[model samples]
Target: MRFYPYKLACLLAFGCFVSVTWIKSIPSDEGSTVMPDLQILYKRLLVAEELGGQVSQDLSSILEQLRNLSKTGNDTYLYSVHNRTGFKVSVVLGIPTVKRDKQSYLVNTLSSLLFSLTSSQCQDLLIIVFVAETNLDYVNSVAETIMKNFPKEVQSGLLEVISPSQYYYPDFTSLKETFGDSKERVKWRTKQNLDFSFLMLYAQDKGTFYVQLEDDVVAKSGYYDEMKAYATNEASKPWLYLEFSQLGFIGKLFRTRDLPMIAEFFLMFHRDKPIDWLLDHILWVKVCNPEKDDKHCTEQKALLKQRYKPSLFQHVGLHSSLPGKLQHLKDKDFGKQTLYKAHNNPPAEVSSTLKHYQTHSLKSAYEGRDFFWAITPLQGDYILFNFSQPVYTSGYLFRSGNIETNGDKFFNTTVEVLPSSVLARHKVAIPHYRESGNGFIIVGEFVNGLAEGKIEAALQPVSALRLVVHSDSDVWALLSEILIKV
Candidate 1:
């Protein structure tokens, strides 16, 4: 669509002119610089044919509409009528330890454009600019200069700068606990930096939604509005606002009321994984099952079958070349086949220090098909369910209870036939499988007694067996001699 050049100039007392050009092709200062007539400005930029590029169609259109309003000499009325339905967004600027000029430019441009567009809507909005502990002084200086140079409408409480530590600052303990060791300090720091800034503004601002903008992202025209519309439309559903790019990560968005639930979910599931991985997991799995009940697997499987109908999301690889595109494959092409081709070498030998149990008694009772027992002990203080087979697709460990010496039923359990020749190797370990060249590993907690203790799968015409362990925890188990029936 049509792209418009935005130029902001700062005039010094010495008659020296400092101009910042938001767009590359457009000159910063042109003509007498009499506040650049909004009417002529709109005419030159807002032709339907001019709005053909993807870069700034939304900005051009909004500007064009404002130009038309000004041209009609109704500027006073248009300015007086408030437009607050649009989404109010803000960017929290963290200190830049290593200055990347390009990133800074992008951040400035996005902030400028976002502020400019929202202003045109005449909506009551607030943009809280935050600087973090790392480069607080530098960011503060930059924000001060920018604020002083900002258009009057933007400067009048519409765009405000605040320090992250001033409000909603998370302590070191919480940061360490949320992100683990100092090894991933940068990522954790960045997240905290943004988290505090966004949350602080969100708590004080009265708005339909709060948009979190990073310092390095470039926004297309209408980006904020589009996001706002999406948030509004999908507010009823368990939806998240995601920017799918090469990064393949989804950004967080929710009603003000859902913040706690969203935060709790993030904390529980995103302990060790990257933010994007966690988002992908949620989008791919949890969003559809907000309750995260144990039955999600079957529901998800049926949903996928119905939704995808005949295809999978490309080949079953963790990093697919085509991210937004989803494809389906035949049973043979499914990624589960790769599970059978386990890493021939086992993970570190199971720790002998932990207590172990024998399955010989149970094996003798069920002698027909090839039998295999996969056991995963509970972690720290958590006990596990003792079950042999996976009864549902949602990865919950269900114990058959027969393995317990007392024969006391631990929990009521159900069983569903393996839908696509896929089997659960360990009860608690996150499920790992390959479908049509796509490989994925899930993150889950598995415990013994409450865990799926053992299961039997029929492998016909098989001469050798391969076991693949995908858990971060070492697979510790006792295996009997391979039993083959002719």
Candidate 2:
């Protein structure tokens, strides 16, 4: 098996990783604490010399499999991340999923991950998806979906799917009495931990770092690079894991060496507590052994950890995975939304209202709040993204107001991409997007209060992008979010 040494995974701008000063502007002063991912290239690169020149055969097999994935289309097993990632195979993003619900978010999440990776960071990582279903029939069905949607990634070895057997779980009969009132909830929670333990064990052979993720989280562009930069720079800090997210256990980066003990803790108290609480207890036991107060235990654990200010991941799941459990979460948009480079602060004057906007306000429109209120409507109002220079943009994404919260706010919403200088020179119009009488090209139109449909055609060399209301009404027009993909 051939092992390739890895460079530091911190490529920021196109050519090379930009200086920490890459973020130049922001869209809002109030709201979620959005800050640049405080990353600087590491002084000490994880080179073969740091690992004493050779790696374990298990890690060797894992890297070889990833390398060969592109050629042979094979999969390899792996486990936890290491305390420090120096040169050796470092991170394996582990996703443990159950098919309790048919509307799976794995494909969307996988697509985001694929789109977010920089060229250099591609080889430094692998994503392992665990179809942790006890039922073989259901497992096979889920596997088929993954194969159908991401055949290329699967064939190239970027993704691997696995299902651990039921026999791998530890017996929990003794702990049944612990869940006096919430038996079903305890059972569900305990099984999730057991599944996580099995996933760690199964994939432990792959790399030194393991990132925990849910099946339904979408990430900001360049998330992997930011995560790698954080992991690389935080090696010297007294930290347990670099938390790339604040929602649930989606983006916690764990060390491979910690998995055996974590899995053991889960097995010992599977029916006693939730996985997140159990993790805190495990850390407390290491620090203040035999600790009692919940506050002290939690604080002690917090002291040893660090989390990114603006999280890298967001939970997009609305429905619950289990019965009687609610799982709706608002999405946080960071990345370029903070810089406001494309003019997101106070959009040009629109219809009647200029200010007093909170939900569906101009600022809120671009706050990266996925599914959050977009700019509401007023009479004759239009929101425009006036860039400093005309940019070549192909597509745009816009979701309507939450259906339950009056999707009627999306009635007659329109997306327009003005032709660029290049297009002006050629005098060519997009086949579907005809030049409207108002001197703008209309690329997309939504009748209902939803951007929830097939994507429209791409717009090229656009100097500006705008959204307008075709209907004149006093009702609020709520936008979920918008993306101008170049």
Candidate 3:
């Protein structure tokens, strides 16, 4: 194994430099139940090994191959690429769902997507929900909910809800009987692959790229913005596919042109095994020539696949589609997400109304410990942070109200960023979680007080920041940690 050094530079997406480690490690077993990290260990193979002698000689040949693969396919009988607003679509998010007896996560999942995405990112994005259940009434009901919740997007042609025609995808009765009762898992999974294929085909012609996700998943904040940054960073590089989420068929990204080949591959092995394993086999074979005698190519090809560190999508707690399965899905990188390193130096001065909760003082706000709780919340409460001088502000994070002890209580926080020179201010809405079905509390560290929401306003160097409640606090506010990037 060869380790490649990727220069620690400004992440084209975040506008800041970050250090990334490169290491040479052995590959994990393919059959293991745990999903491998699948990070593309960057190596300059062409410059280090092959291209030194033939840079100019084989440039045309390489360019020609890329052109062939990237060219729009000759098949005109593709999905009807419809956008009601006439906006050019760049990303197609494909979600395939089924009827569940007790658990439904589609509303939560859709809500997460909308809240996490910025208006700029949503402009060129299309979300296609494919209802792949045998019950037509269930499908229509789900579609109605989607239409009602996201009327703006649905009317704007930003979202599409459809189901596979029965003529194309018949009842899986024969498949179930073929797999038999004892092999229920196999039968469920086999039908799942067919459904995925249907989703891919439907989305293939709608956009430049396609990503498949399950019905029950929540996205990280600023996911679309982060993807744009990642794409910018990867513009000069060659990659086979990009994996966004670690779950099954949830975050596999592909070029729309490649969907035909992938859908075909899925159908070819639909009866043989699970769709996830089938994807692994196909991608491996697609990148590495199975007929080639050289074994080194396989190792090199494996590095072409990439994934976002600390995965961006989390699975919602729900009953599994397959019987006898319980799900408590959590990514290793959920609440622990640190977009950038914390600025060690605190602001010039920090003060709050009811500054002391027992022994916990507002001075210990940045103590870097969750144990030292600096807590207080009252009517017309505010935390005023003053800076001696102007600083280029990137973002701010504040954790309020411990959840383990108090059971998920948060105060509605309104953050105001006032630039030293400008009259305008940057305002970010920090929502508190109510019993109502809504978004994850903005910057709420419910589990351990660790959530951080980035600033989305355009502003100059900051002079000060203010955190306060938009309404009267129904519960006592607890301030665990307050962070700002200078």
Clashes of each: 41, 21, 1
Tens-digit per-residue lDDT, 1-486, candidate 2: 211122211111111111112233223447756545432122122332233223233333433443443223223221112111233356788888887554777777776677534335656777888877657667667666777766656655567676654444444443463536466666678778867765665455567788899888777655777787788888777777778887667788877766655665664565568888887777777776454677766777886778886788888777667666667775453333221112133232322233323544554455453333434465455667775566665566655533233323556667665665544623434455466545667667764343422223343456676776666655555454556665
- Minimum summed lDDT over a 10-residue window in model 3 is located at 13-22
Better of 1 and 3 by lDDT: 3
TM-score of each: 0.34, 0.52, 0.55
Stretches off by above 4 angstroms in model 2 are 1-88, 170-181, 289-299, 330-486
Model 3, 1-486: lDDT tens digits are 111111212122111101111122334467957543443323333222333234222322322332332232232111212333323467788888887767888877776666534456777788877777645566667767877767766765667666644344434455543434446676788778878876775566667767788888877756776765675577456665677777766777777877766766676567667888887787577676656655765675666667876677777756888766788776666454322222364556877775565665656555444323334355556666678786776676665533223222345555655556533332223233221111112222222223455543344466666665556554555554467876
CA-lDDT, candidates in order: 0.32, 0.58, 0.57
Better of 1 and 2 by TM-score: 2
The per-residue C-alpha lDDT of model 3 at residue 111 equals 64
The digit string of per-residue lDDT tens for model 1 on 1-486 reads: 111111111011001100111123333445655455675466446542243232233323433443343223222111111222224433221112223322243234323334214334434444444444335456455554544445443334454433322322223343333444453453454354334323422332235454444343333333445555555555565444432122222123434444433433343333345545554455466435555774775555343211111111112222212223232322221122110101112111112222434542223212322212334423331122222332222222322222112112222212222222234322324233222111212222222213322223331111122122222333433222222122
